[model samples]
Target chain A: MIEAAKTIPVVRGAFREYYFKQARAVEEPGKIEQREFGYAQFGQAGMTRHLSFNSIKELHAMLVKEVPSDVYCSNAYYKFPTQPMQEKQWLGADLIFDIDGKDLDLPCVPSHTYPVCTNCGHALPPSDEKKEYSCPSCNGKKAERVSIPCSKCIEGSKKEVRRLIEFLTTDLGMQRDNIYVYFSGNNGFHIHIGDSEYVPLDPQARSDIVGYLSGTGLLAESVGVRKGREGNMSFIKFPRGGIAYGWRGRIADKLKIDGSSIIKLKHIVDQKGGYAGFKSELDKMTREMGVRIDPQVTTDVHRIFRMPGTLNSKSGLAKTRCADLESFNPFNDACLLGGNKVNVRVKTHVKLKLKGEAFNISKESAELPAFAAVYLICKGLAEAM
Target chain B: MPVQLMTSNLSSIRMGTGDLAKYPFLNEAGEYLRESGFGWEELDRPDMKDIIDRAAERIEVGVGGNIYDKLEKYEIEILTFIVSLIMVKSIGMEPVLKKYALSEARRAEEFLTQDLKQQSEMQKHSLFAKIFEDLFKLKIEVAEDGRLFKVRVADYLARSSHFHEQEWKLINRLVQGGHVYLDADETVRLVRNELSVLIYEKVKAMTLPTLPQAIKVKAEELRAKLAPRYEYRTSAVTEYPPCVKHAIEVMSKGENLPHSARVMLATYMLAVGKPVDEIVMMFQNAPDFNEKITRYQVEHLAGMKGSRTKYSVPSCEKLRNENLCFATEECNGIINPVQFGRKRK
Candidate 1:
């Protein structure tokens, strides 16, 4: 096993090189003085937070000096950013949404990611269902989870990002230019709505926005479906002017049929078995159409989000913004570290491509570029030579 | 003036004294009192006896689940509401203040429902639109048919967070162009909670003044009726499930307990053999506490009322469904909260 004492210097050195040369390139958040910054050093137990900076130069200096494993900035704007939580006097907060590939429950995740026992290195069969962390073979409580940066996970996450943007723009009526999209550096995306009407929304208001996105607690009766009073019979009913707004209209579009007349829709429902059968079809449609997001992240006004353009220690990639989402690729674009060669021991069958170069390494040990080596080391698959 | 001209002028104007009298908490009513040069000292005058008496009845009937009958005189109606706020403040009781606010809000909600249904097309600012905008800063529009009111989705979400009903969910309602559509009754219902909160803040902020003999007597009488009858007993039983403990903690802080949490707490307390009156006493600190309502509900749960069937404490599954369960490691592997700590016992 690679000791923390040995791996700490190797990873820390690689991070220091990036921060020293490219720390100034970190994107400066709006009203930097009002943001609360946080950092975690190499091998640190917890983050040091409640820190604020006055300017970009100060933030860049701190980054270069600390060379932290991770950097975060608050989504909330506070009167006293450095003060304790209750005293921070929150003025407002940017509405941020996180779409993680892991939460999507994609079929490809089980193949690309598997659970390995941290204690004995025993790999277990991966399933898309919730996994119990305990090792069946050794009964160890820890599991080393490895999620390879595959094209499927990325494309799956991007599709959700697109769906979210469509909801934000078309459904929520938010300006497209104000919505900022970023690669979360590992297996996800982050959307930030800054300097917009949504920035001033409180957590409860944000939770409502989350509810609109997730479509939780939807009642079928409220959306143009009701009972016909034949004791157990059900039928579809539309308003006098017909269903033309929100989920009702969205469901109507999903039916893929012409003529939304009451008779035609009712006949269609009857053809699909009955009210229960039609309800299942609509429910399935919502399950596909609902924008999946991490509710906790959006609801938390005080959360210190990973700053854009900063190094993400999870995969040795930058938290880079996607100006053109269709063409932005994380493996190619977010690989910010230099290509200097470094010797490392390969602990497993690792295959990854970085900066247009693919490395299919199954050897005991090999010499690899610093970015690839850092990625493997951060993932706990290899140690420094 | 000609009939057509008068009608056209009426459509573009603000609410009159009659409208303000119905919604006395409206800013215009306050302005009317100010412009009329009515002073707080006038409250102590013998001439204002009718206003003071009606104010006491407002509280008496308001706490009893109904407000007083409408007064014929518009000035007296506005004065009665103002005097009620003064009386509630002078009594210096939190529960009484909350109850008065709720009663007033409910009264306004009834009027608002009727007004929305009757509002004409030419009326530029309906009471519903004005109240939503002024109180919540919510941008709102009404359908031409007057059957529906549209509010921005953000505004709806902010106000509807406390609503636990499935029908109030955003997905259940018609949403178009970032706005949610509500029927007249639903729209009025949405304002009820916030209106109560706004009234409570207004009442709580008013300072008590030296009152005349009649008003002082009314305050003392109302205080005696509303005050707690027993000393609070902090339940020291740690064996209770985490859900019960959490519910008690929230109630003791004078926070509004969700309906399901109240059921969970009451039934769990009943199951543990606590007396109905004692369980009723525990709910006294709830923001909207009413002794008559709480006692009747508790007794009903204990099977001492009409149905004569006691309610069992809800299972862990039910509480989880209601989002009321706050399970911990000590909760063990029990399916129902009643089974928690049973093995150790």
Candidate 2:
């Protein structure tokens, strides 16, 4: 008979931080110190502290007295009595590119400044009064001047400003005058809602928003691809069940289709330029082949933190300034903060070979290429250019 | 025919321990016996061997008697036909045996005539049916002026009608075991496996919806209550800021720590094994550490120091520690010790 090996106890490092900061109050005469422990309950970070003892000896002694003979040491940790409140205020949003558009630059202040377009590098004038400036290069017709930093050229920066304006006034139900939309000094836009009521949402509620948009919540079950015209088709094909790839290939063969054909369809979906372009081609294919396709495109909102930039802290407002002039890449630098935004850029590309023939396609293909493009985009493996 | 009848009788005889040791041709022994409730001392008399030998010979001759042999042969033929019917039914065939008329009526009449002839022959010799009856517990009687034959046992118990169903199932399981005769241990294992399968089938076939629904509802409620409790922090001192001070305080009490605190203190003691004074000093010197030292605290913490005391500790930490202890010993415990000493070759 084989006897199982004895388990050894594992020790983990534990530490926590308590924040103590004094903030000035307008109504009160003096500043008040706000001290709170950073630890939250239920998370690995929060629970670690509860298990820590002054010394390892104490922990071992406890183990000897209370633990059952069969249970292993590494399985136990610090258990807290109460559930931790989730931290909410930190919400994430995405700015997706629905259609390929020109690269735009937004204004950034120095120290917090980001790169601006070399073609129309202009800063918003510093003043309490709101004013608009037109881009001289765009002949004032194409570009509207706004009092915000433009990291891209001044002409292109107008689009981001317009988008922020529309989002604040319409999507978020915020008054245009009260909302402060700023150039994140990169590719995307950031809107700060100063409403105190929206500051601290419980972590679960914050997670719910993330879960909802990510299609991971209870509501996600009902949210499925709508049945469109009978002839419409989706290029991407998902597996029916947990069958292996080899089994799937066999099944596909039995269905009178080869793996290559399915792959080619996926390629076409991902290469399609836009959702409309993908649908039209899919409809055409369905009409000709008598097969229906239901295309589904899902967006995932990933949470991110705002990194340090060139904006000057003393200004207390967003300004047009240049920072990091030496090295700038919008793809790497621009990070979207929390909240709702649409039309994010996703790149999807694939190589298809059929009948001793190989073709490389981008998102611009109209037929099978477009379906593959959309498929890639939907799976998040690639993005539309 | 007589030789075949004798051979059949000899084959059917099941040997007893005493009779088995007596015959030079043990396999040809005609008389058989199961374990009787008789002690060895009762057979110690000088005449016991002769009596037993004579009994065995008489049994052999009686079973070989022409009438007994004829009836046994006919019984075997009928039993073979019955078994074939059962086998065909088992193979998904519709059974028509119940509707068929008796096909061997002439053979049955011949069997009756042979039994009467053999009875007369035995009566002529000083041997009688009484001797055979007493030995085999089987009765032989002629009925309807010797036109029909009947055999019966006064004390023999016939198996229940459902016996075949159970026996067939057991036979199938035993076949899966790859053996004809199952030892007691193997039989027990087979029995347990069959029981488990039976229970699962019974449970699955239950039509009552409320039973499963109630179980599921209770499980969900328990999960909701336990989910929060299951969520645990790693090491208290390192993971949570508030827990550091609490940990220090618990450790300062040493053996005198509270039930919960004792678990924490014992964990610390096992890790560093610091003296009471040293433990007190470490807590005092540490920033934000707020534990007061007491002799009772040291005693409380000490209770969880050894192997035996570890089990009494309630904290998960203690449980895990015990597991580690057992693991370090190569999992050798009172319940499951390493067997066969097949060390890593």
Candidate 3:
């Protein structure tokens, strides 16, 4: 909980200032009146949702007046936006995919995260090596981990975003312009597909799409390596042309062989214990190739998604869209705070680079830029002086 | 006889008379009836006796879980199918309507499989595309080998939602360039349930005139056989444990439940001696419930399929570990949910 008496006002004032000046940066979603809106205020426990807005101006007015810690809009459209869920009469929803850096298997994770025992409050020194740590002092099994994402973590997430976009375009045949990418204002990226064809899909259909993207249940026979009817004979059957299409094409490309070289493909499978061994190889290939995504976010039609231009309460950064992802940097571009300096008392040793400046502060009272002060304050690492 | 369909692209095509006879539920078949000036009054004429007899036989065989005979004359085949639909509507029993639809769909599927196998490449291509689009609004394309069919990812997802097997999952299938590849048998099977649903909807919406005397007698006889049997074995809803009640509530809203919750509910229902069909009916409202798969799974849990090992309800401690326990203060403590109301009963 934020100490409501002390840091809440300071953080709220900063967020209020940003909204007053930059509310125009918020993009207006299509069919505004049909979408539900939600806002969470500072020091509040739950969100106030089932609200509707007719235009961006009305939404901006609320942002400036309420100074909410977070703002959200529904991905689904409804005939009556403010009605109860059962009566919402849902028409359709834009398909959404979320990729968070915290969920990835990054080797640099231990460098940014440290574990503390929940039972006895024992803290462990952070290290670069990857392993599960038990509490040394209390010998308790329960531990709470604290993570502060760095630039490398953000890059790791961006790599996943790139791979996902490639699959959306080349494999799914979604148009380039229809796929929108945004910095989630924290540690991840949010992809919104604007294609109307995808909007009306139900939860079951979206689960299948999720299965396809995540490569959950891929079968060995799909790529044409099957066991023969007679004794122990397994062979490779490719499409007629030496060049196959779809997953067959992908397998051919991975093996660097066309369909004409069935002999070579069979030889490769035989090297790994025939068809059964080749199945594992195919599984490994799909695991390596498939993109990581949060399945629940895509499948839930009733979700209230974070608005694009709203400030994320976790990092005090703006969730902004990337027109050109290659050149976009979240630290400089999405940092919405002005140059006014603020005084804060640091709670712990912290080091980070933001908006072309570096800070390495440790157990000291210091005057810092407003953006940096809000960042640390939001993270509970500092209190207003 | 090959049923030829003509189309250059995704547009609807002209289906032949033979096609109409094989798939009498098609919208074009309805159009063919209107064009031939057939009306409800024609059913009262003396010459319509053969059509009425065939319609009655259709329902009898449908309820017996067998496909009806195909008449030699194409016109009679089409007309008899129309009369069978009317007889089913006159009975107005939901279960019987579903059974009749399923049997008809099965018959059409058999003919469809033969047609897909025997037709030339060009003719088969258009027929496949036309039938899927007309019935389910699905888009299909021919694969490179000319032996398999491909459907758009969106179309395949909507059509295959009810399949529970790991092999039927979209990820497990051969997907390339946004289309899933399926052989002729697999492709036809994808639409079988949907075809049944289509026929069911049509029959349920009809306002049929009074059935002729012969047809009314057959409808009465079928109703006596097919109306839901008394549900005496099933316990009242109020006596169920809180966790079981929660599962039923979730399913009633067509909501998704955790896998453990589903297992707990299915096992508890089976342990209480609920019929497999009744257990299946309880899950009918779930968004992804497919009858064939649901029946197979329920029977499997009942120890009727594969290994014959009946599953017991999880204990309270197990449910608590799985976060499924919904205990309340009822002045009694029990180890398992099944034991909660047992002694009182």
Candidate 4:
């Protein structure tokens, strides 16, 4: 049975130096984290426990010392008048939306979710549980999520960032200055819409915002009116009267008064078969606009996020900030480690899009940048020497 | 006659520090508010002055927080109207007066539409829908689950009460579809909008409260008639009872009506001989419209299916309980639409 220890061997040795070297503490960490609590997942094993620290320094020291593979803080702030965070005195949390790559439909990207047996290291298909899943190797416990990275889906993830940014800025009217886009170290992006403007937004309000951006219960007629012309010809106009701002204004903008765009808007309103074309466009829009946000992150007020500067053990990269956003490339920009090469014996033909170059890597000993080498090792694709 | 609201009388408006109990809003909360049983009624206006002054002070000293957390749903609706009043009366405060005001306005509208749809779902809701039915004198057959079928006004009642069967049926159909569709004196093609406009229209049209003197100075910029209101499409030249007309306005905006209002509307449509499928088609835009169930129900009411028993419209007394009884020259000993035109032999 391959029962690896909770902490990864060499990876922890490498990550300890990276995490402990830098300090990434949030403002007022004591008040917010003390109430909501936080967690740390070391190496392969899950989080240690729900714990809180006295100051940012305590949290920072733990991160530097432990160098856990993953770290998380509660989204909500807690009340501590008499009782602790475990008690039911949650105040609320800032609204945050997270878009992950696993939710996207990347062409030709294969994914698997299999559990590895602790007894014998035998990973089996979960659907065949009644048969071979009895740990045919050593009668070990069932598998948990390995959360391996899917390297092929990186392109699809970059597109998702574009969709979310457009929706947030154009549709939601979120201030560009207030929006912060971060490459979440591994397989996705995290948008931190901070400030008092969104602080008091309740779960219900957050749900509404999510639903609208995701195209859940959208209506066609509400967006525009089809003005009749000769022989079933029609065009859209601003809602019979002047366009009301906010919801109505947004709808009008989408279904504009342009002549060519009118037919596209009208097919649904007039119950015409031409809606199929519009539907296809909408489907594409859904793919582009569909935000795979972690619901709990936005709803919970006392949630702790990964400190921006910490190295994510999953990909061995820091949760880097998009400084230019338009031109920021995660490969080179997030390469905080020394640019020296490390020899890694990759186990799979892992295709990587990094440093603006495509690398069709097979199971061979190759020297890559230190950050890329760690990426392969952390994604379970290679072993470091 | 359409109520011609005047704005030349700003000095005549009430300026006392009042609570939401007096509004345009609290009454509509109906049973939902009472059952929640949290003493919402006991709460007075949460120092609107402090909020405004606080926002002003914050603007001066740079503070960060939302006052929205302090208020409940009903209170938010009233706050929106109050902020709208301030927006209408003041120009200088406009730049700094937004933020919470805009959000509250949007929330108020959201609650209005939701409150209407939730009326039957909840134990208690406003009887405004019932009021429209009674005022228009529409006879509707109500099923056990509150589904309206065989909607019609008796010939005599339509004649005696002077209720237009076609026009009222149109309005009733709109209500049944969970919309506030009213035919008013204005003219336009169609108004693709929401229910929030109705709150503004109904409140401003019927009850324009004078701003409190302390706040009046900030609100002098907006003339009375130019205040924010829901968008609507008129395109009609028919006379309707003001209350009935109001129903049409709401439906035109495509806002959903309460459950009781739907029953009254369904029965009214059936009585008028509208095709069952056409009747069902009218409700396609309704949030909960089901093609199969709606079709079965409509066909059953038309006597084309079900027990084949033609349902009758509700009587005037039943309509009165819904707050639909807005009687005018049509008021006689007439109990139903059929008795409206019938003479005493």
Candidate scoring better on DockQ of 1 and 4: 1
From the highest DockQ down, the ranking of the candidates is: 1, 3, 4, 2
Residues forming the 10-long window of minimal summed lDDT in candidate 3 chain A: A239-248
The DockQ-derived docking category for candidate 4 is incorrect
lDDT of 4: 0.48
Q: Name the lDDT value of residue A35 in candidate 2.
A: 8
User: What is the C-alpha lDDT profile of model 3 across B59-170, one tens digit per residue?
Assistant: 8798678998664576898889988888899878776788889999888888887777664768756766777876677777777777778887777877775665546767
**Interface CA RMSD, all predictions:** 3.7, 30.8, 5.8, 17.4
**Model 4: residues with Cα > 4 Å off, grouped in runs:** A1-7, A24-37, A81-88, A111-155, A225-271, A274-296, A300-303, A337-345, A349-373, B1-345
- Per-residue CA lDDT of model 4 for B72-98, tens digit only, reads 344444444444434432433332334
What share of the reference contacts survives in each candidate? 0.57, 0.00, 0.51, 0.00
On lDDT, the leading prediction is 3
TM-score of every candidate = 0.78, 0.18, 0.77, 0.46
- Total backbone collisions for each predicted model: 0, 127, 2, 52
Clashing pairs in 1: none
Q: Please give, for residues A66-140, the per-residue lDDT of candidate 4 as tens digits.
A: 767676665555555224435647665555677777666454333434455545444443242334345656786
Task: Report the C-alpha displacement of residue A218, candidate 1, in angstroms.
Answer: 0.8
lDDT of 3 at B242: 87
